[model samples]
Target: MPQGISTLAADTPTLSAANTGFMLICSALVMIMTPGLAFFYGGMVRVKSTLNMLMMSFISLGIVTILWVVYGFSLAFGTDKGSIIGWSSDYVGLSGIGITQLWDGYTIPVYVFAVFQLMFAIITPALISGALADRVKFTAWALFIALWVTVVYFPVAHWVWGAGGWLFELGVIDFAGGTAVHINAGAAALGVILVIGKRIGFKKDPMRPHSLPLVMLGAGLLWFGWFGFNAGSWLGNDDGVGAVMFVNTQVATAAAMLAWLAYEKIRHGAFTTLGAASGAVAGLVAITPSGGAVSPLGAIAVGAIAGVLCAMAVGLKFRFGYDDSLDVVGVHLVGGVVGSLLVGFFATGGVQSDVKGLLYGGGLDQLGKQAIGVGAVLAYSLVVSALLAFVLDKTIGMRVEEDVEVSGIDQDEHAETAYDFSGAGGGAGSRKAAPAPGDSVAPAAKTKKVDA
Candidate 1:
């Protein structure tokens, strides 16, 4: 054998068992985020719509997983045909791919890379479900997810991450998915809400969260899983950069939660649990894109800003009469923009990528690039999502009937309820009629009707 050939062969990148294990574990962590999102969204909606909220996120896990293996991965990460999208059928159903083939510049197998990306594809659409919580039809939502991912997500992923992708080539920084995931979903949520219109009673009804505890639990899961969502994007087990991202994620989230509580106390006269949970999510979204590029202090700034901004942005629904069911647009969209743009200012160049922000003396070049990327995604997602919602609304009906929505979406859409209260009355399933206002003899048997 020629010495040059032997030398090249010897230097070829090989799989690292540690990195592979790390990535696989990260994949599982990211996978759990969708269910965490389900619980997060499920708790924010009324009880009547809780199961429906959960189903919306859960269905994405099933649907996107199948689509990803079939063609989604190819379209998103296949050989890039142009800056717009990827084109190559070779990877469809992961055909002709070898188990030993390593991802470019990485130690993990290509299959591991594919599945990790698949988790991202799953959560993007699910994030939008929080916006359309109560009124959407199950069949229509399923169809919408199928079409939206095909048209919007796959192409956008290509534009951001595919080889020779426009944004990637232009040096726009999105460490995780600030633009392709959160901003895209947030803008899409707004567009769909515009088409679907407000819930039956927008500002008139209380429409408070059905279960704050559930929301908190879901938030905790999200925070836990987000370590993978952000740091795992590194696609390796490098202790230096990955550990930096991990610590940044934690500090940013904590800062945002505290900022949110402070804001809540001042604005609403109380520090609410919902504020804490929402604040943490806001911080998570903010740090996802910038964590790799910024220092721990930078992460705190990003988180604090995102927390305050998202808190205020959530009220936009009420002011503008749009009725984002669970503040998806406010938190994800706004926080995403905050994070992505802040990267231009906080990027320290040597830590992650070679880009630096204005504060770091990199000038407005990176910031402008971030803006363009954000605008392009925001416009594309909004227009495309609106058009899709309109077409679905016109043809097969995107929302449930007024009567069904008024009664309950869970019972009508899924034929089941989240909580069964039928067994609450008496022993052996005996019924108990409602007592007159003051007629309760025993406090233990008395039931208080809480407003939904």
Candidate 2:
């Protein structure tokens, strides 16, 4: 539904079965991304934390779905209020709308739009779990997801894509969710990590990824699913805009992957698999916003630029002393900003709207609009997410006790380990168990800082 793109205003009343079917497939594709993200983050953490990492991403599927069905759709897509939020009694619980009711202006049914957007709502918070990996208590993390989405994501979504969303009203062009999703999640990741504090041994420990294959698999799934995440934003394929977006998405991602591998080879003396996966995601994020508005060549430039930038940006955590464990801040935050801003330069004025980029001779007008969109989402998400984490930290606590963190958050948090140690054909498979709730403790190594 894209908050504002599909439902802002009603257009042709005639329903198109083809668009409806296309959207349903896109919705399913978007749903696959959450699991893909789980695998990606799951593989990036140390062996001890793999299950906990995967759970963090997976839990959003359960929590956000319930919330979205209840009031998330209304708060985000309902009628506008002061250009800040939305509300519609009918949308609550998704109970009142008829099955045949079409989205305000699109060819698909409202139910289809709601489910599609539900997938977006789910993944946005899941993206934040990467920063807090290996530390946060599952329950506290769950609560944070519930609260953060209600306070931050819902309103911000309304602001960017809602019918009267301030950004939408301002004519800001967010073809997908550079501002709403990537920047929103990235800023929130930065915010929550700052308040929650660093993971133990964040800098000094080698902390290498446990399984690059899993990371690559997750990246592949994310890349494959993103076509739905981007092209489907248009809500219909009646025009060729959706088709253009699909091509650009592929173009940017490939360019970014190559650029990142090139950079890694030059800087680290090898073309690491992590670099390739990260670069691919960086390109996906960059093209997400600009793909619908730019040419294939422009997409290549965008992806290549984002690739190098994010590859360099990932090292910032080591230098700046932030524990963005999975480079969410680097890939998503930086890629989103790069993509959102580039629209002001590469926009061709022929695809999505008449607005042209500076290079296209549209002057700086569109650039200013994009800056406003980027700054607003970044500032709001950072401040508000920090506040949410701080409140949770003070009341119920966010991180687990030091020993649980050191031993493994997986066992303590979920009562299970990701892999069994027993030989392949053994009884009970030597399952590891969680520590008793009030067990004795021993001191482990203290957290440390190191240069990249």
Candidate 3:
């Protein structure tokens, strides 16, 4: 639209292409993490509801993709009106936003950027369902995700990444998504947990993972995908920012793993697989905000601190009696806060603004800014998300019928089984299930045998 800024300019093509390519790859990477999330969450719940948990994440691949193309992208990245929300002028319904436009100044297609961002939009809401698992109906959950994205996720995205977002304007540095993804999902998770109430046997039963292997697999996938997520934020391969982020990602995660194992061994007498996975995730969350800003050493500190803090926070659910089923709030929200705040202190090499943090002898100014950003993000996300959740609950009836919930939504809503090796497949919709041994395997074996 401006002179000397042709969408087809040579430099523009390179920069745009890089941005587009990286983001598209990141989007794909993020999508895989949902299944990873399924595994991560599946292992945390009782075997009976594992498929249902996995379904929640998978559904986003369909729902959010459609929504983002239709209106979600416009609301998030379209022309800014008042710095709160976007307009439809940019690219509504995939109009005029072609590959050339995508690499307008970057290296990839604009579609790539949109699609990559779409992956993020889709997964952010899925992160919250863990808290509401084994309770909500699939239809209700679907409706809620659709509504919540419109009300909660979109606005927050606008505030953080959109052209005139308040946080962006305020100089809050989220290299990836400390406030946008982590804090927003974490706070909303707490809201839904309150609305949905605890799982049937949350505290009473020792609900072990249906499959530890699945959990480990999910953790591995998430860790891999996160590289795309964090490094891709740079929007291109520029000045080794991506490499720095890539290395920090591993460093912090490793540090967190060790810290968590150490703490668990000291406190619980076991270095649980769950602890290692959780620690990796915690480290990832903590480094997300400051990955590009801090040194590798700084990342280790962030990771270790996040491990200890998140481990401590997870216990809070039990003490306070809120069922954050998969520790989304503890790990994402608290870890995000830690990273966002700590970056102010540990930042070096002039990676960010002129501001230096307390540890850097810049005193408390930067730290105060970090605190303000955290509070603002937390408050905005919590209030908007709660309101959105309440609205969805009232309009569509958020929770499923008690019987349907108890039976599992895979059968009740989708008439599907995640695993179907045997022919006597699990039946549909809230039927009373006789307690069978080996909850995860028998159904599949019987289904396969029947099929044969």
The clash count for each model shown is 1, 3, 28
Give the residue spans of candidate 1 off by over 4 A: 1-11, 425-452
List runs of model 3 lying over 4 Å from the truth: 1-20, 102-105, 352-355, 407-409, 417-452
For each candidate in the order shown, give its overall lDDT on alpha carbons.
0.90, 0.93, 0.79
Candidate 3 lDDT for residue 321: 97
Residue range 1-452, candidate 1, lDDT tens digits:
00001225557778999889998998999999999999999999999999999999999999999999999999998888868888777688899689889876667899999999999999999999999988999999999999999999999988887877898888788888999999999999999999999888878888999999999999999999999888888888654788889999999999999998899899999999999999999999999888989999899999999999989899988788898999999999999999999998899986677778999999999999999999999999999999999999999999999999999999999999999786676685357655788785665676799999
In the range 193-226, model 2's lDDT, one tens digit per residue, is: 9998898888888889999999999999999999
TM-score, cand. 1 vs. native: 0.92
Residue pairs of candidate 2 with colliding backbone atoms: 4-161, 10-104, 11-105
lDDT (0-100) at residue 418 of candidate 2? 92
Best-fitting candidate, measured by lDDT?
A: 2
lDDT at residue 272 of model 1 (Cα atoms): 95
Error of 2 at 111 (Å): 0.5
Which portions of model 2 show Cα errors greater than 4 Å? Answer: 1-11, 425-452
| TM-score, candidate number 3 | 0.87
